[model samples]
Target: MKILHRTEIEKILSSLDPIPKIEEGFVQYSKGLATVPPVGELLMEKGEVHIKYGCIRADEYYVVKVASGFYQNDALGLPSSNGLMLLFSQQTGQLACALLDEGFLTDIRTAIAGAIAAKHLAPANITAIGIVGTGIQARLQALYLKKVTTCRQLIVWGRSAEKTGDYQQDMQREGFEVSIADSIDELAQSANFIVTTTPSTTPLINVSQVRQGTHITAVGSDTPEKQELASDILARANLVVADSISQCQQRGEIYQALKAGSIQGEKVVELGNVIAAGQGRADEQQITIADLTGVAVQDIKIAEAVYLASEKK
Candidate 1:
């Protein structure tokens, strides 16, 4: 079996545009053309690990990914995210390649998925983008959004003032007009298109703070214990979309909202269905929220793409 390291995987990703593939993966998944089992998770005192595996029915290979986050790793000068993906031949049941991406692929697929969410769900006239969190995902979400929206103005809010300042400087260097919001309320008021990328267990954005015509993509709550948006926000949203309805029933903002008796299960729609049916926000005045818990089909598609690209080289 071939083994590709993080550097090689990064190089491969640099040459690839994964948005289309990820979009197709979601469509296939929602159509029942993919096999993705429930996520396996291990929660620790300072970190968490997730094991996701699945295969697209039409694809030649299946993928297994293990990704973890140690919240306190930064003090040791190490990236908190780390993991790898394994691709196996479906026909022979043999491992075909090992992608030692160290969670880079996971991050890329997620960011691309966020862009997909924006492409289908965001408003046409996006004045500014609001980013909640100052981590890697906050940066990637904004960068990937450029693929779907032309809006380069950003207002960011984070718990740490220093981190928000750093995020502003970093985004400004990338040609975006960045501003730091002192609170989530300020960020919500300034930008209609918001992306929340934090692992906070408590709600950050409340329904009262959200305005009409706002689209919020919550990506940090892959686990049941993590939540970033108020349950009332989902209850108040005109449209609520999930990357996977089944997955969201057990995790993410949807689960929290459902548990709180704020939103009904029938009100939730899968992201893939919305994409396939070409259905999104009915009007610019509607408020939309997409609860993204991350899906294994994403790993299957991205891993297969990287493996195929390596052969071409």
Candidate 2:
């Protein structure tokens, strides 16, 4: 099997628009259009806790994603998140290839979810951007934001400024007008499009701080018990969209909102319905939210993109 490195995958990504498009396609895939079967994930709490999972499509393609616990970095001096994508030839049942290093493929897919949120929810003339959390996920989301929107002014708020100055410097190097905010509430008030990428259990942005017409993309809440936004902020949304209602119902920020009696399931809109039915927020005046919890379908779609991208390289 051919192995793809991190730089190789990134170079392939540079020549493709699949990152954002795959998110859109995943919206379609989740809506009962594409034939993505269930992906199995198993969480094992041992020496290094992790979730190992794989997907199947009979004789087509199957991929597996393994996400280790956040503390894995402490032992290895590497980023906590890392995985391999194994691709097999469905027709011949041959092991076609393997992206044996870096979980960067998933990073691109997840970041594109934020990009899609901005494309669908943010105004055409998005002026400013605000981000909570300064992790790798936050950086990737900001990179994709620069790709998808025209937002010039950027603000960031992290749990500790001292720990994440590297994040600020990285943004500045990219030519983004970046600043570090003193508080989460400040970020909500200043930017028209806000992305929450923190792995926080508590709310960062307050409802009162958010201005009307703001578009918020809440990531990092992939599993139950990992919430990032306050329930009241959800209640303030004029339009709320999710990657999957079922996925969000079990985990993600929206699930926390539901537990708090802040929003009903009926108030939520899946991005698939928004894409297929062509009915979502319009104009620049509506307050919109896109809650991304990350899904297997997204993994499958990006894996497909990686396979197609590998065909050329």
Candidate 3:
């Protein structure tokens, strides 16, 4: 079996177009062409590991991805997330390649998914993009949104002042008009499109803070205890979308909303359905919310792309 290191996988991924590939995976998933089992998780005191695996019916390879995150790793001078993907041939059930991507692949695919969510759900005209949390995802989400939207202004809110300032400076150098917001409410009120990437157990953005026609793509709450937006905010949205209805029902922002009884479980729409049908949001005045908990099909598609690209080289 071939072993591809993180650096090699990163190189292969840099040349690949992830948005189309990810969108295709979502379409396939919604069309019942992909087999995705329930996500497995192992929670720890300081970190968590997630096991996601899936296969497309017509694909030659299936993927099993192991991803982990430890917030305390920052103090130890190490990255928080690092994991690998195991590829197996569907025809022969033989091991194909082991991609030690160390979660780089996950980050890119997730950012692309965020972009896809905005493309279908966010308003056609965007004044400003609001970002919560000044981490790798915050940077990636802002950069990818530029490709799908023409918004020039970026407003960011972070728990740390220094980190938020650093994010503002870095994004400014990257040709974005970025500003650090004093609070989440300020960012919510100013920007029409907001992406929340913080791993917070408590809600940060409330219902009263949002304006009419606001669109929020929530990406941080992958676990049961992690929630970024208030339950009331979801109830107030004109439409709510989920990447995986089953996964979100068990965890993510949707789970929190459902448990609080703020929104009915049946109201949330799967994002793939919107993508496959090429339909969503009838008017610009409608408020939209996308709860993205990530999915295994995304891993299979991205891993397949990188593996094929590597083989071509």
TM-score of 1: 0.98
Worst 10-residue lDDT window for candidate 1 reads 180-189
Q: After superposition, how far is residue 49 of candidate 1 from its true place, in Å?
A: 1.6
Which stretches in model 1 have alpha-carbon errors above 4 Å? 44-46
Per-residue C-alpha lDDT of model 1 across residues 138-214, encoded as one tens digit per residue: 99999999878999999999989988889999999998999988888899998999999998999998889999999
- Cα deviation of 153, candidate 1, in Å: 0.4
Candidate 2, residues 12-80, lDDT tens digits: the string is 878888755565665555556555433345565532333333343432665556654555566777677
Worst 10 residues of 3 by lDDT: 9-18
> Which residues of candidate 2, in runs, are more than 4 Å off?
35-41, 44-60, 90-93
Error of 1 at 251 (Å): 1.0
Candidate 2 — worst ten consecutive residues by lDDT sum?
A: 46-55
Q: Candidate 3: deviation at residue 38, Å? A: 1.1
What's the TM for model 3? Answer: 0.97
| Each model's Cα RMSD | 1.0, 2.6, 1.2
What are the clash counts of all predictions, listed in order?
0, 1, 0
Question: Please, what is the whole-model Cα lDDT of each candidate in the order they appear?
Answer: 0.94, 0.75, 0.91
- Between candidates 1 and 2, which one is better according to lDDT? 1
